[model samples]
Target: MFCYQCEQTTRGTACTTQGACGKTPDTAALQDLLVHAAQGISQYAHRLGKMGIRRNAADAFTLDALFTTVTNVNFDPDRLEGLLRNAAALRDTLRADYAQACAAAGQAPEALSGPATWEPAPDLAGLVAQGQAVGIDTRIAALGADLAGLQELVVYGLKGAAAYACHARLLGREDESVYAFVQEALTALAEDEPSVDALLSLSLRTGAMSVTVLALLDGANTGAYGHPVPTPVLMGHVRGKAILVSGHDLKDLEELLKQTEGTGINVYTHGEMLPAHGYPELKKYAHLVGHYGGAWQRQRSEFDAFPGAILMTTNCIQQPAPGYADRIFTSGLVAWPGVTHIADHDYAPVIQAALAADGFTDESPVRHHLAGFHHDAVLGVADKVIEAVKGGAIRHFTLIGGCDGAEGARSYYTDMAVALPQDTVVLTLGCGKFRVIDQDLGTVAGLPRLLDMGQCNDSYSAVKVALALSEAFGVGVNDLPLSLVISWYEQKAVAVLLALLHLGVKNIRLGPKLPAFVTPAVLKVLVEHYNIMPIGTVEDDLKAMGLAA
Candidate 1:
């Protein structure tokens, strides 16, 4: 298996035998095959879209298939096999329909029939050999760097889209066109005759779709649960049995809370789900407890020490420690080969796991975290925030957040936070808060300046705050007195960037070396069109933002 689609690729290169995230060679190969099949189906769908032969059902199915293949998302071999077969069947039906359509038009149809066979690229050595061959090709090699980079961008973007769509699906919302578009885009990449311009265009469209997906998820979240409000989450010891829910799926967290209600099982948010504590509907759950773990990557030790079951709903899932292996239940796309998977997003199995596992030897020994900073909640206090800003009580709004990584360079985030002026308000999202989120940035009046706005999906909350601030100040978002200094480690971040672009958000300060995967040409487009810049020293970045260094 040769996969390097994540921050945790073994040794910063390729995952030859097993993924650092616990994906075995077999599962990785199956995932690749799944992606290849989805591409095949998508290529057919693309042609159909161009020909006006719309197939909404086929399109939605194709989207789910692609989404299922994202890194650390789906690990169930049986589920992967099912999707593979579904994609093949869809491709065959579409191909047959295309042939019939051409026949009616009196044109001969090209034969590209197949049962859709995909073998794992022999081995890691074989992948290196393929890379070597590409390296040696003079004409093709000239664009090799660009090609590989663009592929990374599109792949990451697709993953992000899948995540957003999954959240939408949880809310009972469906956009068949979006699914069709995703399938069509993935299929375009499988073509032998690759078009740089074409791929670049698709990359932008991915960003555009990101905007739509974010809107859909935002609607789903806020509509189902009342807007987020500033409710103080407990960070003290709670007396009772508790279950910790992590990852980014709110639906999963909500369902677990419902199932465990009145059963003496207390629920807590960990990692990305930490933000779930912010929503009004979720906060009302008296049994919903505080955050237990720091970040997703810290699960090995944290989950091991925890006395309750850990439910991971999405990405950033690592190998389970023996201590919590049996107690961990994964729902949605997240999967680990032998782990108990709560399929169909069902909570019965999860509830069962909780009951069986000895939850909190004695009512959580201590409560040590706070969550639930959704948009509605933040907006409810918008007037006070605006007043503080105008009064010069809150001089700046710095959005310093994104995914966390293993790199030591990540320390820059913490250092950067300390360098910010006292009056500056630090707004955070995602696991990136691990940097200096615990620091006391001091409160502007009675409100803490260090406001945690939930998880990465909560980036939608950041966008909402930006737009609202702009409207309140009677200026454009970019014109508002706010700066987004973000750090990204995966595809969901890609989608969020795309959403920003769709909104014409400019001058974002991005860091940790702008994804090594972005092609020079693509980088040019981003820099020229979006004015996106990389993070220098925090002091320098802060100075540029018009704050004292």
Candidate 2:
């Protein structure tokens, strides 16, 4: 039951009894079993691919299994156990196929050990018992913290990359290279006592692969939804039956909007989906209404107060409270006990639930929030931005993006955003922008000071914008007057950070705290190689970035 994969780990250490995100010991144990089983499946799949035999289904399953184990994504122990059983079955099937292929080729098949040869228990008790041998702590005890931490870093980064790959696959986008790297990385992690240097190299390779998947996701999104255009979204209530769709799955939301069209149901974006309103294709829906709430961590209170059904399309789902549990529905790898799960992209159940529930009784005052300032939109104004910079009207550019959580130190982002100099523009993405989305940072050089990129995956947009500026200014990205102050809560953010380092971006300030799984030795390596630093006080960070002193 040991888990420490998120920013909010209990007391900055492992959660041995229960996760701070409300995952039970039983669920945690089941998640560990699922990951181990997936690694076993990857072992066989990787070998099979080498033989020029591809199994897309197995690759997709590996991604789904790993994504489900992400922090706060799945808490249904029954569902996790079901996945574990499925993964074991898949591994056995692949192993036999690989053996047959080798025999037919007149080559002796290799003997498998570790998770590949181990058998799973038929029941929950046995599964928990099986997890004891495969847990990260066992590896830490045998290999020491530095090596264990490096291995976990690669594993976590792979999980995040898998999540993005899954999203792209749903949109009918598949990259065989990404799938191959995913299998290769997982199989590498399952090896017995790899050297620290090898693990570190694999970690960076995982980061490099993450950039590919993110770019794939970005293409999937913009190709399907059209390049994001700056659009003003109403932040007020609309009168009608309503359904709130949260998480980061734009495809799911698009389908729901299509199905709910002309129905009395009004669909509102919540959490990371708030930025979906900026997409031209998705925004074409008349009933797509405005955003409803703040970040994912505040959903307990926010969902209860909303007088309609809610749909969670991805991770960051907390344990549902009893009051709204029945009306909440989950899809796309998010599951909670007693919550209705809409499978196969079906939203009829969600639509019915919205119609049956009490929606907003009355309309509220109107407000607006700006989003969709994606790469194209920002780059369209590159001339003006460059002029401002050269004329000394814009002193600096800071990117305050990444995951937002319930941690108390998260308030530092809001403070930093508000305290930046009037001439500096703040670029934001991810749910982290929820902290300062409503703040009026005013306009600088005729552009709004706060520019909202897309979701966390849209870190691609930020990267693109930075590269464009660098090219325009005839300097490297790190030499530009830009600072990256990122806040990470889960593995996707880890993948994004790895991508940043892979791009040779340095001196970035990351907080509210560094990952618990990153041993001091690993942190030392990062500091020495990349000059990455932990976030200091808001004022201190501002001064350090040359924003203010």
Write candidate 1's Cα lDDT for 47-106 as tens digits. 767777888656666656666766657766666666666666777788888778888878
Give all candidates' CA lDDT scores. Answer: 0.73, 0.89
TM-score of each: 0.87, 0.98
What's the lDDT for candidate 1? 0.73
* Candidate 2 residue 58 C-alpha distance from true site, Å: 1.5
Best by TM-score: 2
Please, what are the lDDT tens digits per residue for candidate 2 over residues 1-549? 778888899888788888999998888888888888888898899999999988977889999998998987899978887888888888889989999999999999888777787687978889888876688888889888888888889989988998998899999988998888888888888865588789888988998999999899999999999999999988868888999999999999999999999998899999899889989999999999899989999999999988899999999898888888889999989998888888998888888889998898898888899999999899998999999999999989999989999888899999999999999899999999998898999998888999999799789999999999999999999999999999999999989999988999999999999999998888999999999899999988877777774
Q: After superposition, how far is residue 222 of candidate 1 from its true place, in Å?
A: 1.4
User: How high is the lDDT of residue 20 in model 2?
Assistant: 93
- Model 2 residue 168 lDDT? 94
- Which regions of candidate 2 fall more than 4 Å away from where they truly are? none
Candidate 1 Cα deviation (angstroms), residue 117: 8.1
